[model samples]
Target: MLASLLDSMADSLVCSVELEKTKGITVRVYNESGKLTQTVILDGKSITIKSQGEQKSSTIIQKEDSIISEVKGSEQTSTITQKEDSVVIKCKSFQVDAETVSVKSSKDSTHESGGKLTVTSQKDMSLTSSAKAALKSTQAMDLETNANLTAKATQNVSLSGLNAELKGTTKASVASDTAVEVTGVKVDVKGKAQLTLEGAITSVGENITTVKGQLVKVEGALVKLG
Candidate 1:
């Protein structure tokens, strides 16, 4: 019976047995040189199996518990990007060259880093927007340290205003400072004006000072005050 079983083991083997009538069977398959290729050990209520080969280059499949797959080669993704562009990635060392790369999202996207993000350009770098733009900081610093806004127009650097307050092409500002100084060709005062003369001053206008009374008023033309 053993010799017949060995002679018929060349192609396949099939058996039907009830475990309650007989003990469990142990099936071990070997290569040509009697080396184990696969194993199957059947116990009363469980079966254990193990395959033999170089684990680094073998594909394992099991049927008992959870499956775990491991790949030692490269992999590819079905969807690279929502955008369409050509890119070159070098694997010999490490490098990436792309014509254009855009990062976009449906919602707001923010990029924050613990280190610094420095950008440098050679020929020209411009920041243009169709809408309004602003630059501000919430840190505590001096005027010079806080904001340094420098604009250089090569040909003509002139600032003109539309005189929004019904003035004639005038630009006026109300600055809150300790002291104010006016220097130009000529200073014009429209509203009721007052000046305190400390030293001997010369007059250049028609009415330098006016003295108001009940029904009469006096206007000084060439008055000297000390």
Candidate 2:
């Protein structure tokens, strides 16, 4: 019967996974006078549990051929994979020392954050972060794109461009349509500070094929003075 209709549609997507998806998961042990009794729930999925105080507990359930994701209220010693289309989540380590975070999507979606992710996208967005990263648009033809960035730490970075760049010191701020390049050097003149524009900037030792920052702003004369 065509393998019984593909095993009844894979057992209706693995029994529609429910059991309140394991509730109130926990782990805690303290004795530094920061008192708060013990609590633990290690292994409970598609849940059902009954444990109280002076904690120490364990439960297990496994069925191979893939499809597992239902862990709630903390303590997830990682491994989540869901397939009907594609989904794979593997974690050997994940810590959220949480404070506040949020996410939502209706159609197109791609979101990632190691410890911090806050997104409110109505249309287009590509945000990647290691720490300090910000992009805000109020929707009039909204376009924001960032392919890569890596920063170890050191503040004061802004790019509100018609174009902007510096792929080396890790700072790329662009408000695109024309020009923005750095590290290969070329940042088409605009109110200078550590500036660069490989063609002209005259006087103040004029060989400046374009390197300004002690004061530089070239727009139409393109700077020329030997």
Candidate 3:
């Protein structure tokens, strides 16, 4: 019935409505050139709509379990799929504005940004990895904490740089279980008030040792000079 109706209006502007017992109902529109420009199908299980333009096209399909919408142009294509459990969107660029948003993946997920990526949380933010995690920056990276910052490792922690300095406003301490050694071409240990060196055995200056003070006194159980 629909084929005969379409054949009757082949060269004219045609708008047809077909209702079939087995296939379902269909509505179609054709241009004067007999080119199909629009189509709509409504069945027991699904509904589909399609529109065609000179340089762009759009299609929408709605089913019992899913709905898909797609648009195509010369430069870009966009598609959206909505299912019972999930929703997926594909396009050239995407942006979202919401009070809260959450994303989860069962297996693995990856996100790539060509330009800059920034994440901001007003309250708190946390990231956890089951195995290992690494952070790298090509140019430079900066980390600042307003409150307190803590880092812990089970095995060992190492810090290396071309030049490194450690400072404390109130006090500073270096403690180890076995031994502590400071090696440099020249080392300076100074105290504003008093300086004390205590150990089981104290040894200073391999090549030469110098003691300078206004009043110098050497006190030991037995003082020996060579």
Q: Model 2 reaches what TM-score against the true structure? A: 0.18
Model 1 C-alpha lDDT per residue in residues 1-226, reported as the tens digit of each score: 9988876675453433334334576665655443325656566544545545443222223324422222222332121111133332322333357986667666654655556655566656577855666656566433342344466645644444443232424554544345445555656555444444332553444546554546653347754444
After superposition, candidate 2 runs with Cα above 4 Å error: 1-60, 67-109, 112-135, 138-226
- Residue ranges of candidate 3 with Cα displaced over 4 Å: 1-15, 18-26, 29-38, 41-48, 51-57, 61-68, 72-77, 81-88, 96-102, 191-194
Report the Cα RMSD per candidate. 17.7, 21.2, 8.1
Q: Which residue ranges in model 1 land beyond 4 Å of their true spot?
A: 1-96, 99-107, 137-223
Per-prediction TM-score:
0.25, 0.18, 0.65
What do the candidate models score in CA lDDT, each in turn?
0.46, 0.46, 0.87
RMSD of 1: 17.7
- How many angstroms is residue 12 displaced in model 2 relative to the true structure, after the best TM-score fit? 44
lDDT of 2 at 163: 60
Model 2 C-alpha lDDT per residue in residues 129-203, reported as the tens digit of each score: 656565565545444446643544455455476664345455546553655444435334463455443534333
* Top TM-score model: 3
**Alpha-carbon deviation at 99 in model 2, angstroms:** 27
lDDT score, residue 195, model 1?
A: 41
Candidate whose lDDT is highest: 3
lDDT value, candidate 3, whole model: 0.87
- Order of candidate numbers by lDDT, starting with the best: 3, 2, 1
